[model samples]
Target: MTSARRTAVAAGVLFLITEVSAIAGLALYQPALTDAGYLGGAGADGRVLLGGLCELVLVAAVIGTAVTLYPVIRRRHESLALAHVAGRILEAALIAVGIVSVLSLVTLRQDGAAAGADEGALVAVGQVLVAVHDWTFLLGPSVVLGVNSLVLAYLVYRSELAPRPIAVLGLVGGPLVTASAVAVLFGLYGPAAHAISALPVFAWEVSFAVYLIAKGFKVFPVADRTVTAGGMRPELSVA
Candidate 1:
């Protein structure tokens, strides 16, 4: 495979990893969020730690997708390409902060349980940490993802890096996700809105990933050159 195709495949794999790891991490963390005494429970420690590790992997994958795609997309639109890199990095940073909050909550629970601390205070702290996580989820995946998807979709649509259908999905999904987040923020709806809003973007990413891995980028003209597996050149055929 040429360098550009290799990068595309790597980005696709990273995108898949980010989605799967995020889901897994959230699943592992759900028990702690639901259980008031999870921090004090000895059995829950392993799950929490594992969940934190999964989230860390998710963060790395999230940033990796952006970095891997930067060179290819930048040729089409420099500003939007840079925005995607910045947005993904910021999203990963927010995710890291959320991870810290949860890990700290776990530590607090363990220490508090051992020290015979007040259960009410421990639960309160846990609640605060959970809230921190919720906000980060809203801002990072909900709000920031909307902006990132739209920018990426536009680039793909214009450059034909991927299929037009895939680009359209991003265009439509980005705003829906963003609107859902705003509604949740204003109490127009509850957290369930996230699931509803996330579906389109999720579909877009999965489909896009599959396309990149199986078919690679479509041949398209960029300025006076054609983009192919070999990178931009004066003339090239689809590879």
Candidate 2:
């Protein structure tokens, strides 16, 4: 297989890994929220720590995947270098957000209630940390993933090389991702208050993975160069 195809395959695998790990970790951690109004008693704190650690792994998986495909994306879509760079910045920001989230979880875990401490005060602190977790987690990844998705979709639409569905997924999934992230960040809907901010993102990642694995990096061949009247040759292709 060509390098581009190989890169696409690798990108797909990374996406798959990220989603799986995220879901698995979340599953392990969600039960910790069993107590509705408040957070962090002894049992809950331990679960939160495990969950946070899982989240860290998930973030690392995503970053690793992006880094692997960065060169491929640059080569394939030179026109989108700026977008790709923006995506990278967003990715870094998202990773930082994940780190903060994990730290917050750790903090809540460490600060287990003191004897006779006001339960209300503890709940308030939990609420605050959860709020921080919600905003950063959504905002960072949404912008980055959304832009990257648009770029990928455009590239797919323009190039005949990749399976049309992969491009189509990029086009459709990108905006949904951005909107969902924004909704979560802004807490637009009551449901948005939930900690599953990354669920839509997980969907997009999974779609990308499927497309890459199934289609590889199949782009339309660039048209041949031709000489103009002035005898100067320029690269041009018929749309």
Give me the candidate number with maximum TM-score.
Answer: 1
Q: State the displacement of the C-alpha of residue 176, model 2, in Å, after optimal TM-score superposition.
A: 2.6
Which residues of candidate 2, in runs, are more than 4 Å off? 31-40, 114-118, 183-188, 192-204, 220-239
Q: After superposition, how far is residue 208 of candidate 1 from its true place, in Å?
A: 0.4
Q: For residues 50-70, could you state the per-residue lDDT of candidate 1 as single tens digits?
A: 999999999999999999888
Question: Any idea how many clashes model 2 has?
Answer: 5
TM values, all candidates: 0.91, 0.72
The models' CA-based lDDT, in order, is: 0.86, 0.62
Candidate 2 has what TM-score? 0.72
Task: Report the Cα lDDT for candidate 2.
Answer: 0.62
Candidate 2 local Cα displacement, residue 103, angstroms = 3.9
